[model samples]
Target chain A: MEELSKKELVLKQAKLAINFGVGVIAFASIWVFQFTIFPDFFKPEPTIVEFIPDSTEPESVSYFELDSADIENGIHVPTGLIVDDGCQDVMVTCGACHSLDLVTQNRATRDGWKEIIVWMQETQKLWDLGEKEVVILDYLAKNYAPENTGRRKNIENIEWYNL
Target chain B: MSKKDSRRTFLSKSAIATLAAIVGSKVVFAENFPKELEPVGLQPDEVKVKIPGKSDQLKILNSKPLSAETPPHLLDDEVTPAHLMFVRNNGIPPEEVDVQKWTLTIDGESVVKPMTFGIKELMDNFDHYSYNLTIECGGNGRAEFNPPAKGNQWGLGGVACTKWTGVRLKDVLNKVGIKDDAVYIGYYGADTHLSGDPDKVVISRGVPIKKALEDETLIAWAMNDQAIPVMNGYPLRLVCGGWPASTSGKWLTRISVRDKEHDGPKMEGQSYRVPKFPVPPGTKVPDDQMKIIESMPVKSIITYPKTGAIIPKGGSFEVRGHAWAGDLKVKKMEISIDFGVTWKTCELKDPINRLAWQRWKINVKLPEFGYYEIWARATDEKGVAQPMVLPGWNPKGYLNNASHRIGVRQG
Candidate 1:
């Protein structure tokens, strides 16, 4: 058997101790660093607030309801765009939750428009249009009629190949 | 050192060397593993959901299945793999609920009564069975519009065929007694807080009475013979065969029978519409430029060749695809290898049901090495087939059914 020199023994001892120390420190630090830093890294950032309709107000307009001026323009205007036509108090109330563009863009008949406003008031909490219902009817009947030209353009003309 | 001590020293020395070797190899092994598997920065679910967005509206949901494609061979047998099935949701998916607590409400212009029944009541009162049906988004192939309209811009994977077991919608309506004036039956989803429209905070859509009375229209509780996953509208949902995604509301909770049509963005003005006139390509149509969207056109895609795969010379392979039509049956499917110069007819297998997609197959001999474009077109019995040219483009994009094409290379 070869006998080890004292210098060699000392060198071997120092090497083993240092390697063991490094391994222990590395393992411990890996766990500690991970435990300490991980939560923040994985945390979810703040999300943009999604729109929520008012649950409390029963008189608020349904988002789809179109006011009278929109009917006159033949465009379903958003609630915000309804001009302050002094004809009726209902336009002011209908303009609160939506823009006049919503109403103007739609092409519903007078009855259909009335039902929509009623649905908004009943289900969506839109406020009453007060006594302006007649004006809204006249506005919708005169201008917001559906265009006959656009109805026939659906799937009839497309070409289809064999199976 | 003693012999045992010497052995320990040797083992420890070798172990240290091995450790160093492992650490070095690990860096290389990390490269070998997919970047997804490594703990770079995100969790598994987060990474799974973050499919690079193709459109502005295609959100990365935290829970829905990541993809909608399955290997042809894996789909060889009955039952589409759950992961491969297409997902159609109007809004964020709802969490799972106890089936017993959930209820289906049937109300509106119906004469007999306003009634709400639990799932058990529905199952017991009506015949329960499974039928195969295909549900596709209204915007499934919308990305193909010639003018490049704005929508999800989904690829060919936005559809799925599945076996849904439940009661017929007509049976439930009959029990409630449909009024004479009922022209439409609107379906409302329980999934709440839809993002875009205020009136649409609760999205409700409907179908004509003719379709509502479809014997195949089912109030499905289970999908693929298992409880429908939460992402796919758990508890119960209405599946309207041959109709677009908007017609079949997910997380369905209410049924309202109406004398007149249900009017909403999803109904009167959106989801189903076409251009008022055939316009030039690449046009962004104004709102006034559109007409209402209706029946789906015929469309087919080559599911094989794996998109850019290189097949060996003299390789003989089978090409397969799926085709479906709205309100009519697919009569024939044709395959064109020479860019429509000459066409070969493919064999279309019998559909599992009238509503499901029919599988098509053709054998092709891969010619000399070059890039080949494989084209498939389907035609319905009504002679309506996929159009090569799309003339309609609208502000709210609708109805994009162009012939499906894929490119492959032969080495």
Candidate 2:
């Protein structure tokens, strides 16, 4: 036990000596850096020489991409319009000239919509709809007919939250 | 501790950590906890439809001929930022507009002295002036029409205020001498029709001779000290303050002075016209009776706290907003929390200049924690106050200057 204690004292002294040696070395290194490397901070040249590293790696860069789902869904992209059950031809023809919202948002009777078509042809320079006019009008009037798309429901009609 | 003891403790802790990581990976991924750590900043959210040169927050009402508006909350800035200004286009903007080659022609039947001036000539010859003017779409409240108006169905967001810097349109008109019989002035723009027809003009609207001569009316080249955004007309546009924004033609290339009222394409057939008399909802009025809309009505919008703002139970709400009347001044403004039954007058400030919207604010300490709506109304210099409910319905659903009601909650 006495021999073990003596060995422990030797180990403790060694640890102390090692710590003192490390402190001295650290001080010397800092002093050397101040005179050698640190002088560059006061140089006439810009200290931040090419601070931005060359971007050769793809991992560092990012880009925004239009998701194919966004285009098919017709929400993010402006041309993404409400797709009715069977209006593929309508989508192609109408979307080619102008937005489909002009057709969907306008709540008109068959005649009202027809008048619009005539106006578009007369002044707005829309080409003749041919036989497809009737079919497209049928789809529009059926789906987006004049319903109650006015202002928000009155405060009385909305769901109430208790105080 | 002894060295061996410390090493054993470290090894055991390291083993426990590795075991925990193995289990945690499975649990976190399965339970959606890993989604929290997954980077979201790199990808764009699908909800917002980003428009070029516009805030992504803007609601796009139509894509073709691109019509969009800023929600009242988003339009809370005193002088609306040029980028944030709403877009109301009748045709696609001209592409690759070379500012150096841009020129404006002044001619028509009533112009005795027809003149053409390059943009540089306009800048060098005339004095430049800047004014913060409010420009609200005629169909701003069209969505509120009961029968559902046939046009863009715009909400209250289709309005904004901005500073336009340019020479007075009146000064330009005087330079190009107007005949004694000059009744109105029409403007032509570089924008082509939707059909790609070279012959067709997108929109050629005009104000009366008196309105055209106003000091605020400008042949604007700069908006907020910057070349105007392409959506708001890049090189030049007419700034017809206090009138329907449609009258403020964009992409201006030519001005035609007319002996009679300007009979431009959109000037006729109830495009920007209201009924001669107050009509019932959904009344089919004739084109002759549809009078041209001169000035907009007095209106106020609550810009602060947004509509769905929630305050702490004991907190008092501070309400702020802007008010403007077409061609006149907003004299008094009031806020009603109890549905116009009792109204507390808000401290309304005078406009910075004529045609600029005046800002106002009030602090309300509500009695209870509950759902509440703050209704704001304004009276014009002519003693005209906004109708609390929907105003008289027009065929095209123009000018429904009803009180702006912002619904809020206290909890």
Off by over 4 Å in 2: A1-86, A149-152, A155-163, B1-50
Q: Give the TM-score comparing model 2 with the true structure, all chains together.
A: 0.76
User: What does candidate 1's lDDT look like per residue over B174-220, in tens digits?
Assistant: 99899888888888766543221223445577787878998888898
lDDT of 2 at B62: 71
* Per-prediction TM-score: 0.59, 0.76
Residue B158 C-alpha lDDT in model 2: 88
Docking quality tier of candidate 1? Answer: incorrect
Tell me, by lDDT, which candidate is best.
2
lDDT by residue for model 2 (B151-261), tens = 787878889889999999989989989989989999998876665444567899998889999999999999989998889888899989889999998988899998989
The TM-scores that each candidate's chain B achieves against the reference are 0.78, 0.88
Residue B92, model 2, lDDT: 65
RMSD of each: 24.7, 24.1
